[model samples]
Target: MSAIDVRALSSVPVEPWRNGGGVTQTLATHGTEWRVSVAQVERDGPYSRFDSIARVSFLLRGKGVTLRHRASVIRLAPLTAVEYDGGTEWDATLVDGPVTALNIMTAAGRYRTTVNPIVVATIVPPGCAAIVIALDSACRYSEPDIGTDGSIQPGQFMIVISVDRPLRVEPAHHGAAPPLIVTIEPVPARTPDSNF
Candidate 1:
């Protein structure tokens, strides 16, 4: 993987849910290993289940949403994220109106995932396997010898690859939705058959 993979916000095909709950747009993916996407929920409905996967999701727009799991419930508000086992059955209830959720799914136990809101200029987590999404304003980045430099347009995203170096992320401008930095690092799961 390269240091940065830039992608503009373009009109991509919308994938409507069979239940007519809403639509979804996949922003980027790395084979079957992991995926980044945005989902818009128009009406309360059940969330899709992904066995053997771990999910970390946050609200991108709208009022907020409530996630109903078997034993507990979760309130998903703007700037807040929720992580849970993807295999769990869950239902969504809109609070005030429809909401858009940004989600990252990675095969369970295969990778370590982190989603952080850009509060200040910071380095891209080591390994450089991350995704940077511009929320309210364009996101800027700088790194020596790195192929990417400039502002990522609002609503756009950059898929970073393996670049073992420091990648700095500037804080979003005032009055803009803070950008998100999602990092995914491979962590091979040990098998019982393997020697200790």
Candidate 2:
């Protein structure tokens, strides 16, 4: 985890959802507790239920999409994210056509993940494990501490830093779009019955 792990979307194999409504290319995962992936939403359908987990999704491509969650109709657009209880009964409707998105899910009571739009030249805070996802164009990054540097094209992403260690991230060059910064942090310990 200390060293960077770069994963390309095209290099990752696509796996169909259990319901077969869409497909996903897993980018990174830590056991069953949390996972990051890019999903291709080919059709509107019910989302699979994942009890005890919370999901955060970012619209990466396509026109947009809307979700019927609880009593609310949530809309999402490119570069935007929405988080909800993973077990909720929800269905998706394409705003214009098929869609692609970045998805992060963490087991409730175990971990938490946040997706934010970061400005170029910003340094990742200490003790933060992060993923830089290229959105609109290719971008480069460097970890001076490790003397390592790399680049990822649009739609690709890289995971750097460890939970125990922090690293600085600077944009290598300018691009049309900024990358989506995904920060992973652990939740405080909770009593067995506290989350229930």
Candidate 3:
């Protein structure tokens, strides 16, 4: 099992040369075969230029934003995740106010990610990578027998074991407030000779 605190993620300044926009990245990897980055969008402008990349953005703070992709426009609110192909032409507009969003961009065909809100106790199937991003400090997670236990505070996250066996996860006892968990899973790999 591995853990990553969202607050501990280092910030990389957005480069204007790459695109006519302002964005900050907390995690970024540009390997020869794969490209992935988790970023925070502080300003709205033209989207990044990467023909074969997939992007997932979740609003973390402030008002939501409306993303215009080709002829499709999607409104994104806090905790809401919006995904699209990077090659598509897209534009964004601040809706309520300045927004802070969590973004994950990866090589188009190499990988894919899904973002969803988790509440209540649940079990994670094997061969999956689970990322729980806590929205409230009152949230907690525990796995019996497997010995996985911890609490997720605001701006913090945890990743359960990467395995092919199912794992259990229980929410800590909190009278009222429900914890929000975000799970990220990489798409299953294909055969060696398969075209990505």
Candidate 4:
């Protein structure tokens, strides 16, 4: 959980939701503390609730969808993230057809997460934990050989971070699509000492 790890998307097992609305593949986890996953929405339905978690989601494929909350509707576009409480009740309406989405969730107050879409080469600096996902096509890495020879197929991912230096990432050679970088940081503990 403290260092870098790499994985293939196809190797993960997909679990169907209890409501049968979609299937999800969990790529990584810090045990019960947090998780990163990708989901395929096969139909319109309500999302599952996670009482003490913070959820950030991004649309990876399909036209997109509108998340209907109690008093508002949030439209999800490819690569753009919409963060909300994991306990929030929402229904999804597909804009076109089936949708593929990525989700980053952390136990509230335990960690912080940020997701960014990259169209060109990107450098993941040292000191933080990060996960890189191939979005458009396959992705190429500068070194440390994640996936296959520094390349991972679209939807495949790698994680594990080195505190000693930064890692560079780039798109595939032809018809490339931007990849996404997710940075995860531990939230500093709050004390009665003072307001930070």
- Pairs clashing within candidate 1: none
TM-scores across all candidates? 0.86, 0.84, 0.68, 0.82
Please provide, for model 1 over 27-141, each residue's C-alpha lDDT reduced to its tens digit, 9 standing for 90 to 100: 8788898998888899998989899999988888888888898778878888677888889788989999999888899889888878887778878656647788886777687
- In terms of lDDT, which candidate is stronger, 1 or 3? 1
**What shift in Å separates residue 12 of candidate 4 from its native position after superposition?**
1.3
What is candidate 4's TM-score against the reference? 0.82
- What local lDDT does model 4 show for residue 162? 38
Query: Of the pair 1 and 2, which is ahead by lDDT?
Result: 1
TM-score comparison, 2 vs 3, better candidate: 2
Evaluated against the true structure, the overall lDDT of model 1 is 0.80
User: 121, model 4: CA deviation in Å?
Assistant: 3.5
lDDT of 2 by residue, 28-91 (tens): 8878878888899999999888999889989878988888986878777877778778888789
Enumerate clash totals for all models, in the order shown: 0, 0, 4, 4
Better of 1 and 4 by TM-score: 1
lDDT of 4 at 60: 81
* Alpha-carbon shift of residue 99 in model 3 (angstroms): 0.9
Select the stronger candidate by lDDT from 3 and 4: 4
Q: Stretches of candidate 2 above 4 Å error?
A: 153-155, 161-164, 190-196
Give the alpha-carbon lDDT of every model: 0.80, 0.77, 0.59, 0.78
Mark the 10 consecutive residues where model 4 has the least summed lDDT: 141-150
Angstrom error at residue 136, model 1: 1.4
